[model samples]
Target chain A: MATKDILSPLPGTFYRKPSPDAAPYKNEGDVVKKGDVIGLIEVMKSFHEVQSDADGTIASFVAENEEPVMAGQPLITLNI
Target chain B: MTRKVNTLFIANRGEIAVRIIRAAKELRLKTVQAHSVADTESLAVKLADVAVNIGSPAASKSYLNVEAVVAAAVASGADAVHPGYGFLAENARFAEAVEAAGLIFVGPTPHQIRMMGDKVSALEAAIAAGVPTVPGSRGRVETPEDAAKVVELTGFPVMIKASAGGGGRGIRVANSRDEFDRLMPQASAEALAAFGDGGLYIEKFVASARHVEVQVLGDGYDVVHFFERECSLQRRRQKVWEEAPAAMLPEDVRARLCQSAVNLAKAVNYRGAGTIEYLYDETTRDFYFLEMNTRIQVEHPVTEMITGFDLVREMIRIAMGERLRMRQSDIVMRGHAIECRINAEDPAKGFMPAPGTIESLTIPGGAGVRFDTLLYQGYTVPPFYDSLLGKLIVWDENRDAALDRMQRALKELTIGGLKTTKPLHLALAADPDVRAARFDTQFLEAWLEHRAAMLEDH
Candidate 1:
């Protein structure tokens, strides 16, 4: 299996859940198709969605939920 | 309200953080820096006695998080919090939060901030205190017709300003009836986008005015002014170079300007450090109250250099409820001081921000030169905040000497990686008008245009 890393496009707080009351968009080991949002990056009080580019199963999340991330930092590792 | 502040928590970052930490160290106080995770390796964190991670790097969850900052102060056993120039520095809610957590907020009270934060209210307050203000709309003007009424009364060439705005974000000048009609809606749109307030007000536009500000320190009732600083050399209304003991202000005019500032401070029963900005029409020798900044300003170092007083330290003392130690008569401006705001932005290519790592750094030193900065060799300039990399300030026996030192200092100072306004500062230092002190608030835009045109011809 080939592992691909999903990198953040912006530097800010990484969020896995869509909202506080909702569950995370994806969990480790969950199968995600192309265009599926894996996490969100919050910068300057705005949220930007980080979507997967290829269909794969999530191997692991490199950045923890609510963790601060830099541009191009790995957010999730996917097994393609 | 005098409370002992042993452990001080710094609730901001960048040069101001470094500034506060140094002041606290001098005062023999333990310091804690509440930083975002991204700024863990910042210079301020390195110098602080303790560092606490408040939240993620996003300012909303970290520096601007009133609750997180208050919690960090209490959790770190900090007795006081210094909200530096930006972030939550002017936030009244943050001040209340710090006080609610039983810690001293090192600035003005929440009420004073609330009163002055809104431009319309500040104008009304200034008038109540007998401070001279530009004639303008008595209230918020939303429509062009209402703005026309104000423009008609104030006469031709009036300024439309945002009711809730600062830092020169929401301002437009109209010279004629057609211009006024076109600018009224344009100014309102910018005001709404910048301040979340579409409300506008028109004021009599005093042409070719100098931007001068007076530094004032107050403890409830007693207030004192630290002379004035001429900040007329600006670009897009951004102050680039500032000098103190305003050049060529008549003796009586200086007295009246300083006195009016004191009167305003007394009117507000202001506390801590503040600056009263004025637009001086050099041609007429008349000055109008522009606005009052409730927090310690970025350009405070110029005033300090001339007055020989540590404004930040004095602010901390004032927050501790101590009476102002100096009287108006006791304070006298000495010599001359000028400050250059060194930003990590290029003058050409439309002043684009160039954030990167500094591979090498050279800071100028010697008598009469001071550099206040957080830049260290190999340190990365983060893109999340202000472009101000540092401020190079110099003091001398007179303006010419100070200008000469600044030019030399500018030549000696270097940051290896980023494109800075250094080149522009050098050119302005040698510009004929700048050297002769012949400029106003409207000077820089035209200067830059002329400089660019000259460059093209070459």
Candidate 2:
């Protein structure tokens, strides 16, 4: 089976950390389980935690911190 | 508390802003309009006492920019802001920001807006207030496991909705466990895209239900319902045709329905005009609370016509902290009213948006007929905003008379240089089921498709 990249399900500003001073939830080369908190997407004062649906090692992070991401746009690549 | 709305700043564009400008003008209040670069030459800007350029065509830079709107209000020296329908109308933070700026947010309080903005929380409040809600999850599920748990408890064939979602986006139906599993990701993705909150909430889907809503006005203490409207005819969760006094409801049940709306509004200490929406199943004669819109709805005109009230003017009065001038007992339903949303869209071409300059325009005029529009000859319908060009409302003594008036008014309306859904609306008015009010929410879409197929057959 081919490894798939996790994409943003909505359009918003993506934040890697919960807060500016907090540690990132997941980093490069980190092993992640299904439903693991990947990052938060802020839309109109609401923060939504974007979760990973596949178990894998992080191949790459496609979105930058505080960057705007579109729906179905790749957020992070996962190596199964 | 005494409030003075000397100057009003409208924080939206298109026909709604124009409508607000007219109402403000009638009230002798100076109107200040903020427009994006695209809407600079629109009718609203032309009619306003003064105009300010905010940003580019992208809504984020103009309408959705709370700071920009507040800055415009401050710069224009306006004492109040009127968020016309969409954008920041129901946004609690925006309301708070407006209040923080020491400007009157001409709607409900931030607390009220926040309480009603969340669907799950709003349902809980409705239940607590003795408002009947549909059989579904009592609260929102945070995880897929939680959603599965709720599904197992409530059984299958449930709907997954976004807590922050509105306008029919971020909703998916699943009939089986496999379907639920497959649809969860897509729905979550959609919810995230639409509302920025992929927080999915599950509810039992009520099929073949009539979309009815009660219009209510409140003064932060007393609340009164102004009867109900049947908005069963819809396309993609947006109301297309609305009629006052639902045709199929029993008299006692209708009274109870309207009263329930009043109770909920009072429970929240809601101010200004709001709508209490419900899903009514005709077969079972059961109704359930759907949601409360804490702003003036597009279909307010129909209710106003039937009840002989100026809802917009009431909103302005309510915003000024004036007590509701009329009581529930004083209100009397006089006539049947119907409104058809006239949009710049071609129904024959999959309802494609047809935006262009109006080469010719002739609006119908007569007693018992009203057209709330901003379109004029030589005016261009912009593609940036919603396709709705105007609303055609007609009132008569009875449903049949109202239907005849609407049909006649629609036939008389003329707008060239762009296609519209008028042809489709005319055809629907002629349908037997529609005339009898036997149609449900899905009637319009299916009927349009059926018409398309018949056209193909011909």
Candidate 3:
């Protein structure tokens, strides 16, 4: 088994849920496919969705929900 | 007389924080700049007499955190807290908390904030003050059938809005009877899911209306108007460009429009700086009250430039219990002024946020041109907040000259290392329609669409 990391493409506040009270797009151990949204990055008051580039199961979330992250920082680790 | 404020704590950031610090210093008030972990190197912090680290970089943990902000203000021994424009500026609970902690909240009372913050009550207050409001349901329309009856009189194209919504959220525009019925339930469900309150209201959508607002100052007893500013040039409901003394506003209409704002302010016994927004229909020469902003607006500089008044200073003085020294007659409008909001965005690529370090900065200057910004050489614009880098304001004796001055100023301005809305402003300054003052609230989106299409063809 091998693990791959999904890095943030932009610097901003990362949100696991689409909105404040909504359920997160994916949880740890959940299987995800390419193009599936894993989280959202809110920059300068605008939101950008973070899609998984490779199909895998989410091994762990490297960036906590509602935490500030920089561009190129690891957001989640996937077991491919 | 109320106790004088000697120390002012700015519980906000960006250019507005710097703007407040300058006003506080002029008033001889010691300034305390509140910053998040990320904004330690910001220009506001650099200029303030003292700086207080409130919390982390996220706004929710810092600027918008009411408890953290109040505690910091109290600990800093600040006599007054200035919530500049956004964040906790209009939050009634925040105002109450600041006052409870024995610090003056440099704006309206908590009651006024809460009243104007609510859509239905604010409309009721406007009607009570004899202000002309858009023709719609008197209050909340709880049922679709009730909405139908109201729309019969006002006719097609009505807006269904959530009572607790702001920032253009929880809104739906229904064009006809069928559309109204179709959207009502869906809109209600969306509002409920989003805001936790399903309460909804309706207003007749004013197509092709210009966004004009009157700037007002009050001392809890006496109120005065600084005339009007036309901000019809908006993108996605956010004002992009603003000008004072709305273009082509007939003298009689201007008089009425300004008077209506004063009436509303006086009715609420409003204190400090506020803006009364209106939707003006050029075709009928009728202006309807949109809502009231209980704090200073981002576009306040345009009004200040035309009137030759320091609005921020006056607001600070008013907060210290000083009476408005100047009367309405003394606040004469001398010239036309324009403001273009320069944002850290790529206008060509759908105004996408482009946050990067300012490798270099060349601020435009030369008489009548003012650039209020937080950008400095080597400063990195954080992605945690708004994209607004600064506002480029220009004033001249007349509208034509002001437009020309704006063009000159935009050309002189330069900010290296990131794409900005500067190009958009440059294009707008040269536009024939913009120069002719032929536009409405909906004009910019259409113009941008056409411009994009033209770019594609080329």
Model 2: per-residue lDDT, tens digit, B208-252?
Answer: 889999999998989988999999999877898999989898998
Interface alpha-carbon RMSD, every candidate: 4.6, 9.2, 0.6
| C-alpha DockQ of every model | 0.15, 0.03, 0.84
Question: Candidate 1, TM-score vs. the true structure?
Answer: 0.80
Per-residue lDDT, model 3, residue B338, is 97
**Candidate 3 residues B39-87, lDDT tens each?**
9999999999999999999898999999999999999999999999989
Off by over 4 Å in 3: B140-203, B453-458
Candidate 2, A1-80: lDDT as tens digits: 45788988655567899998999999998999999999987643346799999999998899988776666889999999
RMSD values, in order shown = 5.9, 10.4, 3.6
* Positional deviation of residue B300's Cα in model 2 after best superposition, in angstroms: 0.6
In model 1, which residue pairs have backbone atoms overlapping below 3 Å? none
Descending-DockQ candidate ranking: 3, 1, 2
Model 3 RMSD vs true structure: 3.6
State the DockQ, from 0 to 1, for candidate 1: 0.15
When summed lDDT is taken over every stretch of 10 residues in candidate 3 chain A, the lowest stretch is: A16-25
Instruction: Give the Å shift of residue B392 in candidate 3.
Output: 0.3
